[model samples]
Target chain A: MKQRNEQLPPGIRGFLIRMGQIDRRWIYLAVAVAIAAPMLARLRFPEVPGRMAQATFDAIESIPPGSRVLIAYDFDPASAAELEPMANAVLHHCASKGHRIALMALWPLGKQLADDAIRDILLEYHPEKVEGVDYVQLGFKTGNEGVIKLMSTSIAEAYAADASGKPITQIPLLEGVRTIGDFQLIASISAGTPGAQQWVQYGDSAMPDAFKFVAGTTGVQSSQLLPYYPKQMEGMLIAIKGAAEYEMLVTEKYPVTRSADRLALGRERMGPQFVAHLLLIGLIVLGNVSMLAARGWKGAAR
Target chain B: MSADRAQQSSGAPKSDTRLWIALLIFGAVGIFAGKLWRPGPLAEAYVEVVTETRVLAEVVPAPTTQGTSTDVQSAETVAPTSLEQENAPTTRVWVELDDPRFKSGELRRVEGVATEVWDERAKVDPKKAREQIAALESDAEKLSAPTDPTGLTREEFEAREAARMNALKVVESTRIVASPRDSIGIWIAALLTLGIFSFLVRDNPFYKVVESILIGVSAAYWMLVAFWSTLVPDLFAKLAPDLVRATMLPGLAPSEHPGKDFLLALIPLALGMMLLWRLAPRGAWIAVWPLAVVIGTFAGMRLTASIEADFMAQIAATMKPLVAYTSSSAEGAAAGSAFDLGGTLAGILGVVGVITVLVYFFFSLEHKGVVGKTARVGVWFLMITFGAAFGFTVMGRITLLVGRFDFLFNDWLGLSP
Candidate 1:
């Protein structure tokens, strides 16, 4: 019965079908243009740092120099674009502060994320720093919160060795450390399940007084983390806006001294976002105008 | 999975039992062959055990004479010291010895060497405290003697350390690290992977597992959380405090007696548990009273927060700057650190968008005159918003797909590293 609606004039019928249903690829094409146009032109837009992102930057800044901070690359390569900027900005901020980091990952590919960060930022830029003492990569273990729970009790039991199979006992940075609580601060940069919410609910909530925690989350997952913020979570960075804001804060205060700048990524992306938002608004208005014209002028045609 | 449907259609069920049997047999044989076939890596041990035991001699709270405390945890390696050396009064001196395990078993039998140092302040008069300690040492020396140890003296010490490690096992579980949860390899886990994704098609048993996994995950989270959050902090940290206060000074804000408070706490706890009675066929309706307060409070909180956080706050933020329409104002040129031209436009559009969206959802009020037209406009705005949101989400997914393609084509193929 609904198939009868398929037969109509091209533009008018297209409008009608769009109002109800339409080819998804057309929408994809529109989105691609919306994104690519700004990128091709190398659009630049100004961004005012959001309060939450500022809070995240400030929280990391407040840590004393030489303090141990664990950065959990809890997301896989899938969310690299949305989350990598935040992670990069955070790494720069921590390195700028001279905070010792013990990099680790909950997701397997997260280790690769750490490796990429190390290769891109750490290995080339900060070549003077020593591993196993200055900063360590504890690598990855195969237990979700089970590992969290284990490390909380006894880190040695949970992880006896580093990713390279060297005993953790040999790592000078991990000396006298018993659990996640030993770290001066912990940051979970993640996307979805086993991400920020898991960190907040499982890790932070378990021992609120033990360690300070902050999260970098995707936009969809941000609202869920909000309830735990300020009290449970010291700070939270949400999606592109959050990343952009955080980048602005970190760069303005403690600028990086190399290529692959963070502030530019966030600000560059914001230009496309602003333009895309405008385009979307226009589309809605046009659709409404078309609806009005079709209804009102039908009598004139008759 | 659809054997019954197939039976009805074809007058017989597909004989897939043979396939299952074949798979089981093949898997078992494959595992056995692999075990027998695989070669082991050739490598030398990186770590070598040095001293197998150390005597925890005089461990003073603050004595400069004592050398640093090494692994004196395993007491036995202390050489018999002269009166001058023993009476030097150091904090904690871990005496060195040869790898005692390689030596005679008698080398492992160091006993009654105090592994703990309380405080130097506790010994106000060292001479007198030493006398008292010597007297107590005689008594404790006897007490330290094993009535019936399960093994040799060395084994007893090993057992003690092992027990200490075991007691610490619970605290070990509370650790938060970025551990890989790479459970069931990518290919072998297709059952759960496909089962979870099955919901995109329709709800069924496959979908049920996915839904149940969500609940199971939540339940497991709370189970671990409750122990560390409530049991450890509340019960462990407060164990001594709860006792000391009740014994020394009564009449505190919360009762110092954990035992009594614990009993009183059970009233609400039991009442909370009673709500689960609804799971039963009979007497299920009895759970309403218990659930009433829970449901009511939940509704109250949800409504109060949603209206304020979502509706009112958003509406208030949507208001345009006065300079948006006022060309004479300085605010016309700058808004929120960006040039005001775009910001002003965005603000005005946001307000109109919000109003239109609300009009669309306003089903209670009948459409009339401008209302019908305004509501129609609202629907268009909402549809556009949904479309935009969907498009953005798809873009994000496509980014992930592209990343996977990049991994396969670039990283693995060494084309893009």
Candidate 2:
């Protein structure tokens, strides 16, 4: 490669070499433009529900209406940008189906995120639903997976009271909910450890057939979780693409009359994502081309 | 060395010039483009709802000739004493009332339920007042012990009691009128974001300041959250339920086995205090005991969990038949025509991939024969997996960047798209 570069004219060879070593700031600017331009133009492409997305939808839809469902929020504000869309859609889906919802958190900040979802999605769309009767916030407990383990045996022991300090015994929704086994379905919107994986190990493993489980995870965390899908986890949604696809399926079935944009966050975010992926692909290709060019045609072929 | 220094000094000016020119171009282009695509006047995404405040108490119906009237009593009928209001348990509820501010026949649900309404305060539930007041008096007596186990001084204890009393009173009645967007908070967030982004150009004091603030705030925030969420609920509440319920956690439910729970909780509390002793001038070694316990307990828990969840489950999942078949439909299964080609190929590929990857890790054989070829195949499979992972990571990172940009444009600049 050095010999070939030396053989070429200094200007052309230097340019070719420089292509790989261009200041990273320039690339950052290009990315910014790629993302911002599409966002400004509102370039959204229609999302078609994929296999995993359809499976996720079916997981929620198959559950009997008014069946007890627990949604464990396991991500904080840091991962909310990626996970919130799916969280909103899933909450809406469950509420629209009239499933008795119970919200809890493994991550400390997860409770705040759950509160945001309840205020923005659940209460906004389903105003007629009462808090203690139709839904309840068990809030954040200190123990990570230990909470799941305890809940697996006895939920009343795990959380003595709801977020508001209301005793679990007094909560009408939790009348018969002695254990995690009482819930018909469980969904974990998780980012890392003490999350969906913990739920699967401690909660699901305790009573495998007691409840159906589904998970929504960030793209980076998806690889570690893929093996559990379709078996241990009945459905899985990976990253914003999965969220967008799932949102399409959910909104089609249960459309909101007001603030429809709240549910369209995932689809709206895909515009920038689409352009940014293209830009990344272009950069990857350019990088490879530069390498090949520096090697010369004969060397590249070899 | 002198010549190299001279060359570097000479090149610095050119580099600086290039950077400035690039910045100018970007700035000019961005401004012009934004102007061209400007939607309209800036609009805040959140709207303030105007609401009025009212305190309603749940009163027991009076007995009548035909039985108690099931109707809820008017607020005027219930006039509880200040002491009763201060000590009684309360539940906050929102009631939608007629307001001229709302559209005709449209009721605005104020205060408690909706996010738009603000300053919805707790009102005492008179029904539970007698029991709660008795519990409070009992708890106060328990707290008035000779030695303060919680390590609070007399002044602090008195202050806490005063705060507790204040917390129980009906909060000030204030109407939430419409106001402008929270410009101050938005500006602070926007400036900090920009400061962080400035590092891409070059490290500067602005970036350093923002970095320090973020680190300090996050550390303090997490500490407070942990103390309240973990220590208070799990340790302190268990040990002194009455005191905790009265002072710190007003909602702490009555423990069934208070004596047993207190004894068990003491173990952790003692260990925690011992761990904190590291900050003392002497006896720092006490911290090591808890440290060992933590590590040992963690290791023991992880061993069984990992073996079950990751090791055995993965192995079981991977051990699949190469020649796979799936039932296409009920009719097709009845006719014995459910040989799925895709499923078969996928099964074969999965098995081959796993085997080759394992072979690559096996170092018993020399790399001069078919073993080397199989190892190379494994390398290909490994590379493909890594490529996919890298792609996903890149996608995730880009999404975060998109989120930041969204905040800047939509929230900060009030740009809609």
Candidate 3:
């Protein structure tokens, strides 16, 4: 490929080759503009909710109001951009339906993200709900899937106390909750390993009939989870696109008295996403064109 | 990483002075814009109340038309006087109330049925309240002693202490005031995000500092969480003698004997200590035993879980009826094809994709003739899956970029489209 670039003509052929080999910083700048410009312009696009997201929403909706729902916050800040929107939206939906949430985290930083979700979404919108009654923060437990394994058999064994060193027995919401089976539904918003996969194995597979399970995961992680969709996993929200679509469904059904930004972060973020994707596609096309043009010039030279 | 690598690459910038100056200017603009940014109007639901004002009781018993209702009425009547007496003093002592309603034997029987009627409401069936009352009584009994005097049953004691430690402080009234710390947090977050994104231009000191801080924070945070959440609860609390635990964490009530999980907890603690032996100058080979245990455990768990969840389950799901003939379909109608051609075709293609991909992976046979053609088809399927995955990955990265941009523009700059 390098030799081919050098053999091209010194005029346009040379320029095409140079374009193909342009500094990565320039591409970065192009991407930044592509994303920022669309965001600034407030470009809105319609999203058709996918089957997986619909299934996820349906699963949560199917559960009786005030049912115990265990939400495992399993991603860090690194993947928060991809996972948090859906996490927030899901929490909002759960809270709106008056579900008792048992929030836990597998990753250390995931606890902070969960706290953010609690403070921003759960607390902000649903101030009427009392902590330890409406919801309980289990915080981030170490041992990864080992925590899930312990939780499946006995949640008390896994977490003796809530995040703030409170006993689980004292939590009003978790009154009779003994194990993961005690919950009516389980939702895990995850990024990588020790995430949705671990939950599926320990929480779903271990007790398939115990509770319904759903996942909101990064786009890259979605492929790994596809096998479990609507089977082991009742529903799945794939990345921000899924988050946006699910948000639309949720807000349309159960509107909240909050800023549109707070209610629809995923959809709001999608504008930049669309433009960036277009830019990427354009770059790919340009690279391909440059490659083909250079090849033709080299053939003529030969 | 880029700074070091850029030095060896042809794309290295001549100087970073301009970049630093630009970043400083951007930072200034961000801080100034953030100061100008005002929070949106609070929802009508957000009613402010002073911190010490306890307006409404947190939990209200479910309305019932039975003996339980009578009991609730009596409790309500008596509650104000008792609450006033308790609240009279500036410093209130946490008291465990003894419910004289149920005797010990009756309480145990009711406790046995608690889990069964946990989800069922007492309003529907009055008998369910017996279980609830039993649970409430047991909770009170557990609080009788937060710490075990003897080393026989610490689990119950610790649970009570955890509850006591985690008790929610009752507030007189509620307020949802937006704190100034929140705005400062946004500014810090925006600045950090900018510092990290600055790498897109070129590796700079700002990015390096933020990156280093992130790494350090991550390590420290992980250590803290692991120690507090796992080592304390699962290992130390389970294996260490009550005296040691009491001495180490005086704030925490002492638990009795580790109970049934003591041996189970000890094994892992020993293994972990052995794993740490690698830090020693000599006999570091002892760590291999624990390392092997960890690896073997993970490998075994992954092997079984993946085969069942990922492999077998996937294959089962893929093996769908090629013809989707519903019960409602007419006798003459072409099975599944008549109702949903798209679904039927998709099912067939999925089955084909799986077979061809499997055949392609089966390299024991030579790639020639029919096998070669199938292999080519398999390659096409693989390419499509990869392409889709690549698209998703790109979307994920773009979303991250968008989130940062949103913070910068919406939160920091207060810019609206």
Candidate 4:
């Protein structure tokens, strides 16, 4: 390393050393371009479905038609960008399969997110579906895992009324639903605590084999849930990539022609992702090179 | 100090024009290599390639009704259809526009004010409220079985209970209109997003303002949710009956499973009151009782839950067959050979990884010789996991950044896709 640094011209050596200490603003600009360029260019890439995403898709597909599926939307607007695409794709697939959606939230703002999904997917694509009869919103309930514990025993105890203050008794879809076990499947698109982990601890452990459980979570949270996948969680979708892969599978099976833009969102978003990863790799390489050069210069001076 | 100054002057870093030229060359070459590079045959043995072309078909918009469908089928009338046509209407209900039962009017405001006064009275003269409650209890004990739970007659209680249930039913069926969105809200959100992103440049007043707003809003939101969901509904509505429930709910007809909800609610209500009573100078020590109960309950629940779910469950899942294959060739060995070998190796590695990682955390057993080697292996496993986690974190952060850009460009700016 010392010999290589000495062989290089003084100007180049100085330049490398200076680049090592360059302002972070330049790095930020590079990142912005890395993300924005692909999006602007409409860059598209082919996604080969991963095992986890494939498992998530299969878990939902295996459920019988018109079967009740509890979607615990345990995220807020902050995480919407990461989790929403998968949420939309999953909901679209479920709707196509004619599943009865029982929407609930453990987070406060999660109720609004559930409503957004309902409005964007359910109300948008499947307009003929009635609110109470075909789908029901239990709204946001506090108490975190305590709410899940209550629902495991009795759904009504936890959620007395829907988000709009409608009694659970009046919901036609919830007529025979007494406990979490009544549902055929439960999918939690979670960002943090009182999320998939809570569902597994409270709901799954309470009544194992009663209902299939799947999860879609942020990438950072995936490691925590990794041990449970293909076991406690029959399926898992990690982050945006998982969302894109799962979207591909769903759209392939049940294509929503007019809503192609909505369905293609996850895949479309992957373009920026690939570009950003490349940029990160470049930054890491350049950073290391700079470090080595600086070290060599120090040693040569010594 | 003189030696340090001489050293700094000799090896001082300086910017040069060659850096930009070198960076441009490096970037161009890197891009070219990325585009052109392919794995060798050896790499192909461990890699999988899958490619497909897909076309998104255009859907003809179905002629949907503009207004509410007049031919709406009642939930009772629509029979369950097969999975063939999912769109077929399965269930619907006739929602009356002017439903009388939903007239649970602005009675809650009156109840709120009354409850505040009653709570203040209870707070100021606890002994008086206690005696009044004891007298009311004695009067209730003297009354006949069917008289009434409170001071009201059985007939009046029943009638009020029915009315309250009706009001609840009406409120339940009510559909709220969607809140309209305007450009102002979008602009505010955009500004906030930009403010947050500004931190990447440098800490600024804009970022501070956004951060402060977020902290303030989150605190206020939690307080509001706690009040409505827990304090008001669970505690205040149940305990301060005369002021809130009697006036607003008007005798919330005892739940079908009455004792459970009422008694279940009572414990927390009393505990919450004790927590509030800690504000008093005299019985401040009494606060520890509720605090202990909460701590004990939470600890017990979390302990059992974490032990079972995070510990035992993970171990059970990890306990997989080392060799995944049929015992005999009659079950077909050739077709399953590859999968079996892969699964067996993975299972063995998983078990080893878990054990070594555990050993790495075992500070009691000094790492030397064989233990040192194993611990070193454990470190590698940890590093690999951390690396993967870091990569995923990068992906997550990038996705968020992309979302912000999408908002600024698409939603905020109306940029064409």
Ranking 1 against 3 by DockQ, winner: 3
What digit string (tens of lDDT, one per residue) describes model 3 on residues A35-76?
877776677788888888899999999889999998889999
**Model 2 docking grade:** medium
Q: Candidate 1: lDDT of B361?
A: 79
DockQ of candidate 4 against the true complex: 0.67
Location of the lowest summed lDDT over 10 successive residues in candidate 3 chain A: A1-10
* Top of the candidates by DockQ: 2
Residue B156 CA displacement from its true place in model 2, Å: 56
DockQ of each: 0.09, 0.71, 0.60, 0.67
Scoring only the A-chain of each prediction against the true A-chain gives TM-scores of 0.86, 0.92, 0.91, 0.92
- Best candidate (score: lDDT): 2
**Residue pairs with clashing backbones, model 4:** A166-B172, B102-B170
CAPRI rating of model 1: incorrect
- Tens-digit lDDT string for candidate 1 (B62-118): 334244233333222233356657654333344444434324332243358744332
Better model by DockQ: candidate 1 vs candidate 4: 4
Worst 10 residues of 4 chain B by lDDT: B40-49
Superposed Cα deviation of residue B41, candidate 2 (Å): 8.2
Better of 2 and 3 by DockQ: 2
True contacts kept of 4: 0.88
Tens-digit per-residue lDDT, A24-136, candidate 1:
33444465456645654567777788778878888889888988998989888668877887888887788778888888888878987887777566654567778887788
Q: What lDDT score goes with residue B186 in model 2?
A: 67
- For candidate 3 chain B, the 10 contiguous residues with the lowest summed lDDT are B117-126
Cα lDDT tens digits for candidate 3, B234-310: 77766764544445543344346547668889798789889999999999999999989989999999999899877
True lDDT of residue B211, candidate 2? 98
